[model samples]
Target: MAQQVRGVVARRKGEPVSIETVVVPDPGPGEAVVRVQACGVCHTDLHYREGGINDDFPFLLGHEAAGIVEEVGEGVEDVAPGDFVILNWRAVCGRCRACLRGRPWYCFDTHNARQKMTLTDGTELTPALGIGAFAEKTLVAAGQCTKVNPAVAPQVAGLLGCGVMAGLGAALNTADVRRGDSVAVIGVGGVGGAAVMGARLAAAATVVAVDVDDRKLAQAEKLGATHTVNSRTTDAVRAIRDLTGGFGADVVIEAVGRPETYEQAFYARDLAGTVVLVGVPTPEMELKLPLLDVFGRGGALKSSWYGDCLPSRDFPVLIDLHLQGRLDLGAFVSETIGLGDVEEAFATMRRGDVLRSVVLF
Candidate 1:
């Protein structure tokens, strides 16, 4: 028999989400049903509600989540019932070319559950990022549930599934920030702050944080930034160059996915230095940089997709680091709300009043 659970649903674009009774079917082949313990209020979830991602009406919102597996479908050996896990969107297909090549992080054909969760009227609900977890329970492919140290709290552990992981992976994996390298992160949101911490974790010679807001800059400093720059009232490129001994940062991370910030990231790095764009940009946005600059600066300009992370490998290690008192995963949780508080959480997130307003079950 199917289960009925309360969920936050976006019935239409730009309208408030509502708590509705969602019908969750029992797991089918390659699927698992999760009893969500905590889910973060990510900007992406807001994007989905605003019709920024797609026109998938009546979408099931929420992706950054952690929970206990209640049931597993046939052939699901990786995770079993009672296991605590963090949900991820990218469930790699083992036979994909990227996986066969040993770079499973770049798995070209990731997947989600085949069955759809629906409303009482039988209208299909599109799960946000293929892992709609804002509800009491969610369905996901088995591979999407990465088992981690269960001792960690659900709210903090869940964050590793999205934004924070993106930042850490951008600095530690994509840019490959090394000891003695100078790193500067632009935009001190949850992602940028994590990038700063990643640089510090890598023992970078200098970790500079650039943001338009002073409050965020202060938060970055607390998160291991060696220096801070208020880009709104200063020349970011010049300040970054000055901080880096008249050159620039060896790696510059653009966590604000806007054209102006991207341009700043381009010029704020040393010649031949890497620029990692971890920010999610809107489709209408475009960059118009001079061609010569791209040619003259001979390093890589890359975009990090989900922090170029492999959940099975990265999530456990990161959770361990948190458990060991290394990564301050708790700082990101500014407040905790209920499933009914999602609308207000969205408002708080829009005002930049909170780093992450988590929904606790």
Candidate 2:
């Protein structure tokens, strides 16, 4: 049966999102219907609203979510009705070359539900990141629902579905941050702060957080940063170098997608160190760097897509850590709001007023 649910929708670019009744179709083959309990208002959702992602209007706008499996389509085995799960956008196809090469995290062909959820008048709603969940109910591929312990709150568990997981994975998986390592994370937004938390989880010795906003820097300090650099007043690259014994951080994570921050991350790392780009960049932006420096630096320059996380392997583990109190996932939720408040959440997000304003269904 089809489900009618309230959701936040972006009808046009540069406009506020509206709460509307959306139609969530029944689970089709290889799909699952989720009863969303909570969804976070991520920067990516705002980007989608501003049409920074694409011109796909009438977009169903939330993706970072955790829910209970309400139903599963034919052949769905990993998850079933009544299961608590975090919905992920990347559902790896085992047959993809990346999966065949034993790297499912880089799966070339991740998938979502084949069917589309539509408006009452029959307009097809493009689900944001292919896992829209601002609604009370949403449909996704079975592979997208990763089962996790239900002891944790949905608001916290859902965070692993997107941005938080991406940040943590960038530090642990992409950058492979080792214990006692010196790390610097640029842009202390939700994602960057998570990288700080991840670095701490990985036992980094010195986690220096760099950002322009003092509020965000303060938040980063609680997350695990050994020092904070307000880039608006200080030279970020040089500050990181000074903090790291004048050689720069052993690993630098750039969570601000601007070219300036990118270059900062490029030069803020130690010789032969790692630089991880986890921030999303605008299409109009271009990055230029010295060719000589690129060779001289001599280390891996990597971009973490969803933190290069294999949801199936990482989500449950992170959730377990959260439940065990080893990770402070609850700290990420700045406040809880309803679907109608998405526009306000976007404003707060832009102003760096909150780490995340989650929508509670």
- The TM-score, computed over Cα atoms with residue i paired to residue i, of candidate 2 is 0.98
TM-score of the candidate numbered 1? Answer: 0.99
**CA lDDT scores, all candidates in order:** 0.94, 0.93
lDDT of 1 by residue, 114-152 (tens): 999999999999999999999999999999999998999
Candidate 1 — which residues are off by over 4 angstroms?
A: none
TM-score of each: 0.99, 0.98
Number of clashes in every candidate structure?
Answer: 0, 0
Candidate 2 positional error at 84, Å = 0.4
Error of 2 at 284 (Å): 1.9
The root-mean-square deviation over C-alpha atoms between each candidate and the true structure, in angstroms, is 0.8, 0.9
C-alpha positional error of residue 340 in candidate 2 after TM-score superposition, expressed in Å: 1.6
How much lDDT does candidate 2 score? 0.93
